[model samples]
Target: KREGDKWILNGQKKWIGNATFADILIIWARNEADNEVKGFIVKKDNPGFAVEKMKDKMALRIVQNGIITLTNCEVEEADRLQNANSFKDTAKVLQMTRAGVAWQAVGCARGAYENALDYTRTRKQFGKPIASFQLIQNHLVEMLSNLTAMQTLCFRLSQLQDQGLLKDEHASLAKVFCSLRTRDVVSKAREVMGGNGILLEYNVARFVADAEAIYSYEGTKEINTLIVGRAITGFSAFV
Candidate 1:
């Protein structure tokens, strides 16, 4: 809605990160006239803007998520991102951020795998270190393999991004593959840690929860898979 020379925003945004303390917020809203999405930077002290912190998150607790509400929040046209015109612009941002999510998956998987590996070396079962057992060794090797593959894939994805050769499908493929593999790796980590796996003191349990969050963040596994599938077959599988 327009008020004199400024636009008034009314809506709510969920899962906003660092919202309470953010000096500036990049708010995206749909334009009523054309139904095109537009981006605006709202100052922290805007009276019409309010934020409520989201609580009881299982992972990424250090980052504060919030629910932002705007009731007739006035914004100057100058605060708008001039280049951002439509949902495609918003998608450009998501595509870039999705690559970071893929990297996050790899890091989570690697950390869990490493921590579990160390625990196995010191953890004894039946009077022998669990790492010496054939079954436990298999889990370790599998986790390491998945972790290694994700690392190499992310490295190449970064290179493609740096070279301006990265496409939406490329990032989507990486996001789906890495996040799915990370889930497997974290599960194996918890499995190898046995009874201690669920304990927060053991460290693997935190990764287990965080891995689950990563798996569904940016885009769910099914969503990203459809994106890659569409690119490969020229068929839009998203319904």
Candidate 2:
């Protein structure tokens, strides 16, 4: 709602990371009058803004996620993001960040692979190092293949970004592929570690859990797939 030069925001947000301590927030809301999505910069101390931390998280527990409530949150016109007039403008930011999330998937998989490889080499069974076993080597190879493929693909993604040719579909496709591969790679990493894999002391456990978060954030596999599907087919499936 608009009151002269101010906007009154009322809403609730969930699964908001870092909101508990964030000094400022970039809020996206739809203009009731124009029905166009707009962005606002709200300070943490705003009278109508409140945040409550969420607990019992399964993944990405290190980061504080919060629930935000806005009750007649008053924001000045000067605080509105002049560049963000519509969802399309907001999408420009997501497209770039989605590419970065693809990179994050790669890193997560790499960490798990490296840790698994080290454990296999040191862990012994049947009077020999497990790394010497054929099955273990096969799992390692599969993980390596996925990791390499994801890395090379993202390398091209970065190049496209640098050339200013990055598109939403490109980022979505990369995010889908990399995040899926990361899940596989991390699972294999945990498998090779045996029972120790689930133990936080091994670190692969954390990677396994964190991969789940990565798989869903920045867009889910299904949503990103639709973005790519629409791009290739010239059909927008989004309703």
- Top-lDDT candidate index: 2
Deviating ranges (above 4 Å) for candidate 1: none
Top candidate, metric TM-score: 2
**Whole-model lDDT for model 1 versus the true structure?**
0.91
Per-residue error at 27 for model 1, in Å? 0.8
State candidate 2's TM-score.
0.98
TM-score of each: 0.97, 0.98
Which stretch of 10 consecutive residues in model 2 shows the poorest summed lDDT?
A: 217-226
lDDT of 2 by residue, 1-239 (tens): 78899999999988888999999999999999999999999999987999999999888888999999999999999999999999999989889989999999999999999999999999999899999999999999999999999999999999999999999999999999999999999999999999999999999999999999999998889999999999999999999
| lDDT at 169, model 2 | 96
Prediction 2 global C-alpha lDDT: 0.95
